[model samples]
Target: MATSGDETTAVRGTFGFNAPAEVVFGVLTDPDRATRWLPVGVTAEPAPGGRLLVRGGGHRAEYDVDIDPDRLEVRWRPATGTGPHGSARVGDAPAGGSEVSAEVRAPLDEDRLRRLLGETVTHLRRDVEDNFNAG
Candidate 1:
């Protein structure tokens, strides 16, 4: 719920899936799945002072985590390009599925920011859901 007024600057969304937090967490943190959502290739060195270079998914923002920020919020982006900083947080849903919230800062027009964040969320949800269903 990030939409505020007729002109919002950031876009935040939450998605639920029929999977567990651990299951969905892997989808977001695993480097193998980086290309599925990240803007650029995965270059996280798995350390606190590691170098990260992500420039894909339309936007081109760049930032670093303080040694993985709970080992979950690894996604980063700069404000210059079209990139958005996003992360996936999973929790147990009352109905048994897992809830994943994606907080993205799209530094673009309201329309484009919303659209990009929405599409990114949908794609990630589908991928994780499909993976769960397949198992």
Candidate 2:
């Protein structure tokens, strides 16, 4: 993913959940499941060219879906900032679970980038854990 203004800065995070690949994929692709763990006020069509909106706690994020059976990628541009492009990929984990990875790019210095990436990874991990446990 490339930042809005700086193409050189890239932030990436990967998380693994103890769920089957299809199950994890379903949770990611299904709007209801997505909202239950990710954000609020969500609406998604789960198809190509469809729009996905997530809003809550005075924060809203919108993205266009570019989906496939094995992957659901979105380019998110938020409402209140210089939004960077975002994409998430779900696949088989190395051990016996599913893994999801997301990348976001923004104009942040090296230290900020590291912190942001860490936070993103933690957030994704918690979300995926919650989704998996809720099933």
Candidate 3:
């Protein structure tokens, strides 16, 4: 679910996995696993200025990848102008699953922003769950 504030919008999704935090974290950090959940043709360099691009259907998103172990943040900039910003945090969840929370800030209206945030969270949750089950 997503929570909207005055200045920031956050969407948090949790999945209970049949694995430990370290195991889940490893999957989240692995590039091959990331591709499984992230949009198609998505590539992450896991460094500053590293490209994080996603393409699906007719829509595409590009951002700079910034990684900090348990946290991953992306600043989406499709054009030379200012762009939307987003971040994802991975933490230990009760039971055996890992919890991931994502927040995005764009120049879009409230409804559009909410929908985008929700979709992003859903995609990520499904991807993580799929990887966890496959492993």
The numbered model that scores best in TM-score is: 1
lDDT, each prediction: 0.57, 0.59, 0.55
Best by lDDT: 2
Candidate 2, residues 5-123: lDDT per residue as tens digits? 44446767676778766766666666554545442332333333455665544645566555677454444544344544566777787667877787766555656666755655554
Full-model lDDT, candidate 2: 0.59
TM-score of 1: 0.65
lDDT of 1 by residue, 95-118 (tens): 677777666664467676767666
RMSD each, Å: 4.9, 5.1, 4.8
- Candidates' TM-scores? 0.65, 0.58, 0.60
* All candidates in order of TM-score, best leading: 1, 3, 2
Candidate 2 has what TM-score?
Answer: 0.58
Worst 10 residues of 1 by lDDT: 39-48
